[model samples]
Target: MKENYTILAASHISGVPTESIRAWERRYKALTPQRLQNGRRSYSTEDIEKLSLLNKLTHEGHSIGQIASLSTKNLKNLYQKHSPQRHPLAEDLIKHLHDFDMEKISEIIEESKLTLETRSFVLDFAAPILSEVGILVENEKMTIAQEHIISSILRSHFGTLLQISANLKPQKRFIFTTPEGDFHEFGILLCAALCLSRRIGIHYLGPNLPAHELIMATKMLSPKAIILSVARLPKDLQKVDIPTYLKEVRTHTSASIPIFVGGDGYRPRSSADKGIQFLPTLAEFDKMLENFTK
Candidate 1:
């Protein structure tokens, strides 16, 4: 038997804006709420659950357009698969790291199976988890060795995927790297993995690459895009002329090639930069890629 829920009731249950629900129905044919003889739209319980999951995914930085196309079953599958391993492991790993329990840490690492389970783990899982691990180190909850252990496992995991992806398509190459003095490359590696999943051609430059070298590499390879991952700007470097350096690189490259900046350091300072696009997270970056491909 179908259970009926009014628009307001459904909105309350699903946490979706009523207007958004209306728009989804009108634009995407996403949710076809039944019409009563009196002309009010009424949603079923199944509809409510689907809309709830859709709201969760949208809040997680997925596009409404993409979510609209997924079946209820697919949505459930995605949620079930990714929700369990989101950020808790990194937090727990840090706690374990503080205790210096090598045996337990080894057990945790083995249980986490970061390398073994990486293929099935989505980008949403990996990026936040890594970020959490970084925070643990930054907060001194874990020693550098513990962080390195987890990072080494992830590096090997992503490195294997990168190798496999490298063998695929040869079209539209991109070179990804971290800017000068920015040592964080986990985001860059995750981006590489995402590109791999899509079979997009990419050459990863790893971390701590100078701008001049990046420009020179750009001139040599002529990649479709140059992605710079800047996790944090050192205090000394913050005062350095970012615009001047960007302009310097621009002089040597075609104006059409897009330069995308990602990670924490690239967070918006002002709306002044016309040439650079700041991508805050891997999910946001992936959406940009999706739109570009479409």
Candidate 2:
């Protein structure tokens, strides 16, 4: 049986303009629809679905050029791996840290075997545990030097995983950096480890990148995605000019490349914000990547 879709059918199904669809085919070489004997272009069911997902992501601020390159299977797989799981370890890790129980932390680390297990231990457990340690420091429950001891241990664990994952295959380029004055990189490094497991190439820019440098780097590398880590909300974020900064990057880029904003700083806003997508946590960002491709 032959399945076919007309221009209107494709438009209705994809929520993309028929003319824009045609233009994409012409300019971007996104899809190659067959022409029927009567001279109308006919799309297959697979083509329609791919176009639909592509349209959704692009409309939500991803680039069409990036979408064109992603296979539907990869897109679906990416989303599935990222969906949330019941991470009890995360809760337990926090509890232990609040009590300053070093023995419990050491015990859990010894019992965990897999890399994802370790990742879960660190992200779900250790990271939040560290957060509690910070609170303890603020209240003078723990001294600065003690906090450093725990922090160093967590960094060592993260570094170990990163070193192993770096040896994997089929690397894709990822640009990671914190915005100016936002010196936090722990979360960014964790996210990088996850990307590395999938064999994504990483070009971590570390902390405190100037906005202009970020734009310049984007222009230079033209990476598939630019992950901007906002560890702490800038004072400027409260001002109106933040939107202008976001728009500047959008105007400068020719590709529909996605700009993924993550960290504790930015809250999720409505999709209509134009250029930015706010992801509250690494877990949420990981889930969204399941459907993201290009």
Candidate 3:
């Protein structure tokens, strides 16, 4: 059961103006608080979190009307993409997510990028921050929607890095993408960033790619390897099983193209495909890139 907070309490905790909250609730339908015995409105924790995000985004120039219909995940991702900058500590970063302090959060990300090399940037700052956020999300201390904001910000950053390094000489050819139904592509994007920093030739086909599409891509491109990301284990293994998909992919491509599977949700079933191999973490993936390309 969730605790219900009064309008004043929600406003205090979320740092939102009471009238503004009421206006948003009425106009945007941003939140639907419960009515008390006296017909007074009361909010839940999730309601406050959602309101906080809405307030932050609107403060950054987003129109409440335009964003009114967005899902929580969509809202967070929107905030991340457009948020401005500030330098912050790890603790500050975590706090900012709840506080919805986009400027300070943006600053910390930009500062990390400016100061660190690609590998250090990823291993030192990106990885640690994400690891902390992941734990919080798992523990229910942080909302999944808010975490997507971090992913969106980093995804934009890494995409730029990959693009900038696109003209560099190729060390090896690879195709990076997530399997169908696994909408999570941040893991592969981060990996591609590291790969690009090393001047490796990478063709990144972003998330939600069906197996047939991959087969077509493999045949057309003829890359040295096909790297499929299993970022989030399929909710239904019967329909979207990684190993099954890997085997199906293997049947379409030549035996020459080695298939690599990875990410947090990657769990090969008991009877797995022989061709598809799993790399447990980015550290392991980095080592493989070093070994394979060298």
Clashes of each: 0, 6, 2
Off by over 4 Å in 1: 1-122, 237-240, 269-271
Per-residue alpha-carbon lDDT of model 3 for 71-141, expressed as tens digits?
A: 76677667654544322454567788888789989987777777777876776567656766776687687
lDDT per model vs. reference: 0.71, 0.66, 0.75
Best by lDDT: 3
Tens digits of per-residue lDDT for model 2, 99-213: 7788986665555534345436645556555665665686686788767766887777767766675565443577777776666777777777667645576777777777788
Give the Cα-based TM-score of candidate 1 against the true structure. Answer: 0.61
TM-score of each: 0.61, 0.56, 0.64
Supply candidate 3's per-residue lDDT for 251. Answer: 94
RMSD of each: 12.6, 15.2, 15.9
How does candidate 2 score on lDDT? Answer: 0.66
Q: Would you list the clashing residue pairs of candidate 1?
A: none
How does residue 22 of candidate 1 score in lDDT? 94
Q: Find the candidate with the highest TM-score and give its number.
A: 3
lDDT, residue 80, model 3? 51
Off by over 4 Å in 2: 1-107, 113-119, 135-143, 169-171, 233-245, 268-273
